[model samples]
Target: MATDSAAWICAALLAFLPLSTARAAPLAPGQPAPDFALRDQHGQVQRLADQRGHWVVLYFYPKDDTPGCTREACRFRDDLHALLALGAVVLGVSLDDSDSHARFAAKHQLPFPLLADPGGNTARAYASLWSLGPIKFAKRRSFLIDPAGRLARIYRKVAPDRHSQEIIADLRALQQGHAPRP
Candidate 1:
């Protein structure tokens, strides 16, 4: 009985841990970014392949309109002009439905496309989807793909509030042929 109790305690503690497992191997810089054709909040199908020749900021968040996600999306919205001026297009992805994305984008007045990945296919391809028993969602990850559709940088752990500016700085450095600091 004591051993069973200890096992139960251990399992309970594990459940409380931040244990997100990536489904695939960690992607490397200069590798081709995974291509995805997903529907956005506006119901338009957005394809990564189509965004070739322009820098792409493909960000995967866990859900829509949550505190962290909102901060991240709004920061992107607030800084959209800077990103565009740098020849970069920002696409936010989440494991939410189109309706959720629509509401979130509209509520935040986010100008960028918030792509829905309800089935987690895109998230898994980027190695960002995480599952804890029945609770599944995408980890907060971002990929900066160069104009040639190659991964320029991978952000495995991101701070929602500060990520956009981080991308902006990196974009400038990358465009200037400066090596991005890890």
Candidate 2:
């Protein structure tokens, strides 16, 4: 009876607690990047397994068309060719639905995929989701997945203005057989 009462109390307390926790620890470098299947702005299903043999830039942003998100996305747009030349594919993920992504991608002329994670499962897998009661959004984070589908680096603190450039430089270094300083 005592143990049952304690368990009941704990469950009741948990129900009353604020729902602000992320899913799990962020994946470490060298771990195989989590596999995800999500529909992009065009309703095309994209899978991480398909991106093998090319560097994958998997970036998670908070919303569609917001200022910081725009800046980060446009920078990637401007540098897309360079990144492609270096065998990289950029993927942007957010909690927005496909309709929102279509508008945002059209408005910004983004050439890459902006994946819809309306349920935030992908963001949660990446340890990038933030929740407050009923509200949730992805934090600004990026994962650099190598050609073998392993995480090369994880950017927990991102500066939107120079993030693409930073990735470009890092890709160059990694391709040249040196550890990226950034």
Candidate 3:
């Protein structure tokens, strides 16, 4: 009975720990964003190094067309022009393959590149990969990389419906040489 009671206490303590604590610490502001070369939906390679001198919104999603992922993608799609006007380029990352990304992009008419991270390397580098048993998925997270390739901000818990607008507001503030809102 004592052994069982101890085990239950351990389990309860573990359950209270935030999932983020189980993974690596996310890339914080002022850290250099990790460079990656992954194939986009169009089968062309996209590299982070190539995006230098432009603000890059690197967002990771769990699945290609799931409800939350779809909402996030469509939100980005709806705000593409405004993002572009701010000189920001949005690139989405997922553990799904290129074929899946292509279908998702087409279904939503997404104007941005959805990069495929089949091996989850980029996702892991960004501390956005979630694994359970034999399945792996990318967490819903976003990194704002500035022109110098440094992380401007990191959004660990993203609300899909409002994330695009949030980023846009941040970009506007950042571009005007003001600190972004918390």
Candidate 4:
């Protein structure tokens, strides 16, 4: 009976462990961004290699159209022109299907591509995939890839409302040949 009670306590504790703790080590700055080809909201294929010569904002979110995810997408939408002016393109990735991405993009009027990573392959490559039992999702992480295809920065924890502005500031600093803030 004592063994059974101890096992139950261990199981309870394990159940409460955050999924983020299970994620693989994320790619570090200066590492080459892992190349991938995935379908975007419009069913168009987007490849990281094709984005050479441009700054790429590769963000991974947990789900499509959720509260925080929506806020993040809308923030990017609002800042799309500013990002473009700095030679950057934003691409949001999530473990959602194409149809879900389409709706989310249309609803938010996002000009950038929201890549459908249904199988979480791209997220796994970035080490941003989070899973709890049979349920899997992407962590709220962002990677800034330089025009040279190297990772310029990685945001391990993101604040949805402020992330876009933060990226813009970083881009400006990078463009001015100054190192981004730590």
Candidate 5:
């Protein structure tokens, strides 16, 4: 009888292994961002080190052409000027292929580049890998990388509607030498 109980407990514990493996923590603020070179929507190569002197907004989404993702891209489109003025460049990252990214960008008229993290290399590097059951893509996350290639802030719980405005505010504050709000 004791052996049966032990076997059941072991089976239960083994069943939960997949769940524990699925959840991953995102990158912490103040850590040096992992550098990567991925192709943009146009197949143009983009590397983190290339934009060393400019602030980089590295945003990773689940897929392209989705409602929330579209809204987030549009918000960034409308706020591009403000962000550029604050000396920041926005780069959207996703697991989508280059063709999908191009179509999404053209459809939405996004002003910034949409990078393709085909193997989710950049996503994993930034700690954005999504592992909930069958979902293998990265979660919708945003990282604010400073000019020196260090993560200044991370927007884990993104508000797709207000994402652009919130990022602009954070950039403005950071540029003015103020700590971003929690």
Candidate 6:
């Protein structure tokens, strides 16, 4: 009877599994990024328009201090020098409030700025907002924008362990006038 009940539960879960959909968010490469003005942890404004002439690495994460998010942020912090040397400026965005962001930044010793997207409006504009595991907020997404503001690459399935290395590699290739490999 227990075996039968377990099988029934498995079958029910399989029946409710998500079907593959073609309506996923559109790929945004080669298009100009939408400009934004958001406040950072320090309560100062960060305007995308003001960064027009610099290569921008804009990463949207789910939260401030969760495990996976922390790993990703630390990786970014570790590789910050290489990123800046490649002429890229990194910015992190999440639905975390400024106070939370301040704590996360100070705790992690992050060298770059983190933008606070408390209302989720910025995440929605970038199609990076989602809910998971009872937490309603932004999803983990990263975009590499060129100096002229064209979206050069989007990393949706980023591995927190090696994400910074991957971004650094891509930036190096871009600097060398070569297209990055998949």
Which candidate number would show the highest TM-score if scored against the true structure?
1
Cα lDDT of model 6 by residue, 96-162, tens digit? 8888999999998987889998777778778787753234577788999999998999897889899
Report lDDT (Cα) of residue 41, candidate 3.
96
Off by over 4 Å in 2: 1-19
Q: Is candidate 1 or candidate 5 better by TM-score?
A: 1
- TM-scores for candidates 1 onward, in order: 0.90, 0.89, 0.87, 0.89, 0.85, 0.84
lDDT of each candidate versus the true structure: 0.93, 0.95, 0.91, 0.91, 0.86, 0.85
Looking at candidate 5, the ten consecutive residues that score lowest on lDDT are: 17-26
Please give the TM-score that candidate 6 achieves against the real structure.
0.84
lDDT of 3 by residue, 1-182 (tens): 99999999988876765444126555679999999999999999999999999999999999998999999999999999999998899999999999999999998899899999988889989998887545688989999999999999899889999999999999989999999977
Worst 10 residues of 1 by lDDT: 17-26
Q: Model 3: clashing residue pairs? A: none
Q: Write the per-residue lDDT of candidate 4 for residues 87-117, one digit (tens) a residue.
A: 9999999999889999998888988899999
* Candidate 5 lDDT over residue span 34-62, tens digit each: 88888998999999999999999999888
Q: List the residue pairs that clash in candidate 4.
A: none
* lDDT, candidate 3, at 136: 81
Model 6 ranges with Cα > 4 A deviation:
1-25, 132-135
Best of the two (1, 3) by TM-score: 1
After superposing candidate 4, which stretches have Cα over 4 Å from the reference? 1-26
TM-score ranking from best candidate downward:
1, 2, 4, 3, 5, 6
> Model 3 — which ten-residue stretch has the worst lDDT?
17-26
Error of 1 at 97 (Å): 0.7
Model 3: lDDT to the true structure: 0.91
What TM-score quantifies how close candidate 5 is to the native fold?
Answer: 0.85
Candidate 3 regions exceeding 4 Å error are 1-26
